[model samples]
Target: YKETLSGPTRLISIDGADHTFGSIPWQEELFSNTLEFILANLS
Candidate 1:
Protein backbone atom coordinates (compact mmCIF):
# COMPACT_ATOMS: atom_id res chain seq x y z
CA TYR A 1 0.00 0.00 0.00
CA LYS A 2 1.15 3.58 -0.69
CA GLU A 3 0.68 6.30 1.92
CA THR A 4 0.30 9.07 -0.65
CA LEU A 5 -3.02 7.53 -1.65
CA SER A 6 -6.14 9.37 -0.47
CA GLY A 7 -9.87 8.60 -0.16
CA PRO A 8 -11.45 5.13 0.27
CA THR A 9 -9.36 3.49 -2.47
CA ARG A 10 -7.41 0.29 -1.69
CA LEU A 11 -5.33 -2.34 -3.52
CA ILE A 12 -3.63 -5.67 -2.84
CA SER A 13 -2.32 -8.87 -4.42
CA ILE A 14 -2.79 -12.34 -2.95
CA ASP A 15 -1.18 -15.75 -3.44
CA GLY A 16 -4.01 -18.28 -3.28
CA ALA A 17 -2.09 -21.43 -2.26
CA ASP A 18 0.60 -19.89 -0.10
CA HIS A 19 -1.31 -19.99 3.24
CA THR A 20 -3.41 -23.07 2.47
CA PHE A 21 -6.78 -21.48 1.70
CA GLY A 22 -8.25 -24.92 2.32
CA SER A 23 -8.04 -24.13 6.05
CA ILE A 24 -8.47 -20.35 6.10
CA PRO A 25 -11.39 -18.86 4.18
CA TRP A 26 -10.21 -16.22 1.71
CA GLN A 27 -12.95 -13.72 2.53
CA GLU A 28 -12.11 -13.51 6.22
CA GLU A 29 -8.41 -13.93 5.60
CA LEU A 30 -8.34 -10.90 3.35
CA PHE A 31 -8.20 -8.14 5.95
CA SER A 32 -6.77 -10.43 8.65
CA ASN A 33 -3.61 -10.95 6.63
CA THR A 34 -3.27 -7.30 5.71
CA LEU A 35 -3.92 -6.14 9.28
CA GLU A 36 -1.23 -8.42 10.67
CA PHE A 37 1.33 -7.32 8.13
CA ILE A 38 0.58 -3.64 8.70
CA LEU A 39 0.63 -3.87 12.50
CA ALA A 40 3.89 -5.79 12.45
CA ASN A 41 5.68 -2.68 11.19
CA LEU A 42 3.73 -0.10 13.22
CA SER A 43 6.43 0.20 15.85
Candidate 2:
Protein backbone atom coordinates (compact mmCIF):
# COMPACT_ATOMS: atom_id res chain seq x y z
CA TYR A 1 0.00 0.00 0.00
CA LYS A 2 2.83 2.40 0.81
CA GLU A 3 4.45 1.80 -2.56
CA THR A 4 2.17 4.34 -4.25
CA LEU A 5 3.36 7.37 -2.29
CA SER A 6 5.15 10.08 -4.28
CA GLY A 7 7.12 12.09 -1.72
CA PRO A 8 8.86 11.74 1.63
CA THR A 9 7.31 9.11 3.86
CA ARG A 10 7.87 8.06 7.46
CA LEU A 11 6.70 5.48 9.94
CA ILE A 12 6.87 5.99 13.69
CA SER A 13 6.10 3.42 16.31
CA ILE A 14 5.79 4.34 19.95
CA ASP A 15 6.30 1.67 22.55
CA GLY A 16 3.23 0.84 24.68
CA ALA A 17 1.07 3.25 22.76
CA ASP A 18 -2.45 2.20 21.90
CA HIS A 19 -4.40 3.35 18.84
CA THR A 20 -5.63 6.43 20.70
CA PHE A 21 -2.33 7.29 22.38
CA GLY A 22 -3.98 6.91 25.80
CA SER A 23 -0.92 8.02 27.77
CA ILE A 24 0.49 11.46 28.26
CA PRO A 25 4.09 10.60 27.42
CA TRP A 26 3.15 8.70 24.29
CA GLN A 27 0.94 11.55 23.13
CA GLU A 28 3.75 14.02 23.71
CA GLU A 29 6.14 11.93 21.67
CA LEU A 30 3.63 11.59 18.87
CA PHE A 31 2.95 15.31 18.74
CA SER A 32 6.63 16.18 18.98
CA ASN A 33 7.58 13.86 16.15
CA THR A 34 4.68 15.12 14.03
CA LEU A 35 5.68 18.72 14.55
CA GLU A 36 9.28 17.95 13.69
CA PHE A 37 8.24 16.24 10.50
CA ILE A 38 6.03 19.12 9.44
CA LEU A 39 8.75 21.67 10.13
CA ALA A 40 11.32 19.71 8.20
CA ASN A 41 9.07 19.48 5.17
CA LEU A 42 8.17 23.16 5.08
CA SER A 43 9.55 25.28 2.21
Candidate 3:
Protein backbone atom coordinates (compact mmCIF):
# COMPACT_ATOMS: atom_id res chain seq x y z
CA TYR A 1 0.00 0.00 0.00
CA LYS A 2 2.86 2.36 0.69
CA GLU A 3 5.04 1.53 -2.31
CA THR A 4 2.48 1.71 -5.10
CA LEU A 5 1.58 5.39 -4.87
CA SER A 6 4.10 7.52 -6.69
CA GLY A 7 2.00 10.29 -8.20
CA PRO A 8 -1.63 11.30 -7.75
CA THR A 9 -3.12 9.60 -4.75
CA ARG A 10 -5.16 10.36 -1.67
CA LEU A 11 -4.43 8.68 1.66
CA ILE A 12 -6.93 9.47 4.39
CA SER A 13 -6.37 8.09 7.84
CA ILE A 14 -9.49 8.14 9.96
CA ASP A 15 -8.64 8.27 13.61
CA GLY A 16 -10.36 5.68 15.81
CA ALA A 17 -11.54 3.83 12.73
CA ASP A 18 -10.95 0.22 11.76
CA HIS A 19 -10.97 -1.73 8.49
CA THR A 20 -14.68 -2.64 8.73
CA PHE A 21 -15.74 0.92 9.64
CA GLY A 22 -18.70 -0.52 11.45
CA SER A 23 -20.70 1.60 13.92
CA ILE A 24 -18.19 4.42 13.69
CA PRO A 25 -19.16 8.09 13.69
CA TRP A 26 -16.76 9.01 10.89
CA GLN A 27 -18.19 6.40 8.55
CA GLU A 28 -20.10 9.14 6.78
CA GLU A 29 -16.82 10.84 6.01
CA LEU A 30 -15.41 7.64 4.58
CA PHE A 31 -18.35 7.25 2.24
CA SER A 32 -18.27 10.92 1.32
CA ASN A 33 -14.61 10.91 0.43
CA THR A 34 -15.03 7.75 -1.64
CA LEU A 35 -17.86 9.33 -3.59
CA GLU A 36 -15.92 12.50 -4.12
CA PHE A 37 -12.92 10.62 -5.43
CA ILE A 38 -15.02 8.59 -7.83
CA LEU A 39 -16.86 11.66 -9.10
CA ALA A 40 -13.65 13.61 -9.55
CA ASN A 41 -12.06 10.85 -11.62
CA LEU A 42 -15.05 10.20 -13.82
CA SER A 43 -14.70 11.19 -17.45
Candidate 4:
Protein backbone atom coordinates (compact mmCIF):
# COMPACT_ATOMS: atom_id res chain seq x y z
CA TYR A 1 0.00 0.00 0.00
CA LYS A 2 3.08 2.23 0.05
CA GLU A 3 4.42 3.87 -3.10
CA THR A 4 7.88 4.50 -1.59
CA LEU A 5 8.63 0.78 -1.62
CA SER A 6 9.76 -0.54 -5.00
CA GLY A 7 7.01 -2.93 -5.96
CA PRO A 8 3.59 -3.17 -7.58
CA THR A 9 0.66 -1.30 -5.96
CA ARG A 10 -0.31 -3.62 -3.18
CA LEU A 11 -3.27 -4.05 -0.87
CA ILE A 12 -1.89 -4.60 2.58
CA SER A 13 -2.49 -7.39 5.08
CA ILE A 14 -4.48 -9.60 2.75
CA ASP A 15 -1.94 -11.75 0.98
CA GLY A 16 -1.07 -15.39 0.35
CA ALA A 17 -4.78 -16.04 0.74
CA ASP A 18 -5.89 -19.49 -0.36
CA HIS A 19 -9.50 -18.57 0.37
CA THR A 20 -11.05 -15.37 -0.87
CA PHE A 21 -14.48 -14.47 -2.26
CA GLY A 22 -14.25 -16.78 -5.23
CA SER A 23 -11.67 -19.21 -3.91
CA ILE A 24 -12.13 -22.81 -2.81
CA PRO A 25 -12.84 -21.99 0.84
CA TRP A 26 -15.22 -19.23 -0.37
CA GLN A 27 -14.63 -16.49 2.15
CA GLU A 28 -17.30 -14.12 0.93
CA GLU A 29 -17.84 -12.58 4.36
CA LEU A 30 -14.17 -11.71 4.69
CA PHE A 31 -14.14 -10.30 1.23
CA SER A 32 -17.30 -8.30 1.90
CA ASN A 33 -15.87 -6.87 5.09
CA THR A 34 -12.64 -5.95 3.41
CA LEU A 35 -14.46 -4.40 0.50
CA GLU A 36 -16.76 -2.41 2.80
CA PHE A 37 -13.76 -0.43 3.96
CA ILE A 38 -13.46 0.94 0.48
CA LEU A 39 -17.14 1.81 0.30
CA ALA A 40 -17.22 3.43 3.73
CA ASN A 41 -14.12 5.53 3.20
CA LEU A 42 -15.09 6.50 -0.29
CA SER A 43 -18.66 7.31 0.64
Tens digits of lDDT, candidate 2, 1-43: 3331223332343332345455557656755687577779894
TM-score, every prediction: 0.37, 0.44, 0.41, 0.37
Model 1, span 1-43: residue lDDT tens: 3441222232233353435444658644665666566667676
Query: What's the count of clashing pairs in each model shown?
Result: 0, 0, 0, 0
Q: Write down the worst ten-residue block by lDDT for model 3.
A: 2-11
Which pairs clash inside model 4?
Answer: none
Badly placed stretches (over 4 Å) of model 1 are 1-24
Q: Highest lDDT: which candidate?
A: 2
Top TM-score model: 2
- 2-34, model 4: which lDDT tens digit per residue? 241222222343464423424644444645565
Candidate 1 weakest ten by summed lDDT: 4-13
Of candidates 4 and 1, the better by lDDT: 1
Query: Better model by lDDT, 2 or 4?
Result: 2
In Å, residue 38's CA in model 1 sits off its true spot by 0.6
